[model samples]
Target: MIITVPIELPQEIIEEIVQLTKQRIKEEQSHQTKVNEIPPYPTRKQLKQILKIGDSRLNNWIMNGLKTIPFGKETRFDREDVKQFLNDLKI
Candidate 1:
């Protein structure tokens, strides 16, 4: 058995609770976004397989702060991004 009582709340108080809940949700979303925004860190062996390049060349690129876009469903790299990166390197 359970007892239930419906108590009326002041309109302002109800609105304030709703506002606070919305603020809490927004704060959580902001925190999650920051947490998920991590930079990529590719390994030497993996890089050799994916790029199908020589270790010497891959090592050269990796040492210079080269990284991929944040990985999603699959490991993907944009050719244009690579071009821009290489252009920046002047190599």
Candidate 2:
């Protein structure tokens, strides 16, 4: 046996859904802003000094994504992100 269901949503329901979607998007963007608040760039040496880790361990951490170290054509680290990562470690 087959059951029939309504094909179209009511206008009010659609509007509510749209509003909720927008609200959720706004919230997500704000959360991203907070996460992205990490600071200016720093070199690998500086980062290693700041975190007090050896080259191998630092490389491993970067590989594991414990910190937001960017790689590729440009090697850079956000200072604030490093600080935040360190701060997060205190917990």
Candidate 3:
């Protein structure tokens, strides 16, 4: 069930509310744009599962040339980077 309440406001107040709503929409769009710029970097555990590789194998790849972005104590790899790394490998 839905309920509706009737309220009255001055014309100026209504106009101000509409303008504020537009401003809020613009702010949300800007925030969304920034969020979209972030890369989908997978954690080490996730990468291991995705690639079906063990710890030693993953470490070996990292030692060779697999690029990793370290965030403090955690390591992450971009999806595209991992794809490129696999493509570069002849096997």
Clashes of each: 0, 0, 0
What is the Cα-based lDDT of residue 31 in candidate 2? 52
Query: Residue 11 of candidate 1: its Cα lDDT?
Result: 74
List ranges where model 3 is wrong by over 4 Å. Answer: 1-39
Model 1 poorest 10 in a row by lDDT? 34-43
Return the number of clashes found in candidate 3.
Answer: 0
Q: Which of 2 and 3 is ahead in TM-score? A: 3
State the C-alpha lDDT per candidate: 0.56, 0.64, 0.75
What C-alpha lDDT, on a 0 to 100 scale, does residue 82 get in candidate 2?
Answer: 62
Q: What global local distance difference test value does model 2 have? A: 0.64
Please give the lDDT score for candidate 1: 0.56
**Which whole-number lDDT from 0 to 100 does residue 87 have in model 3?**
63
Which candidate number maximizes lDDT?
3
lDDT of 1 by residue, 1-91 (tens): 2322367888787777777778998986774454233224444444455445786885577567555555664444444454455558653
Candidate 3, 16-66: lDDT as tens digits: 777777899898677545434435898888877655689999899889899
- After superposition on all CA atoms, what RMSD does each candidate show versus the true structure? 16.0, 12.7, 14.6
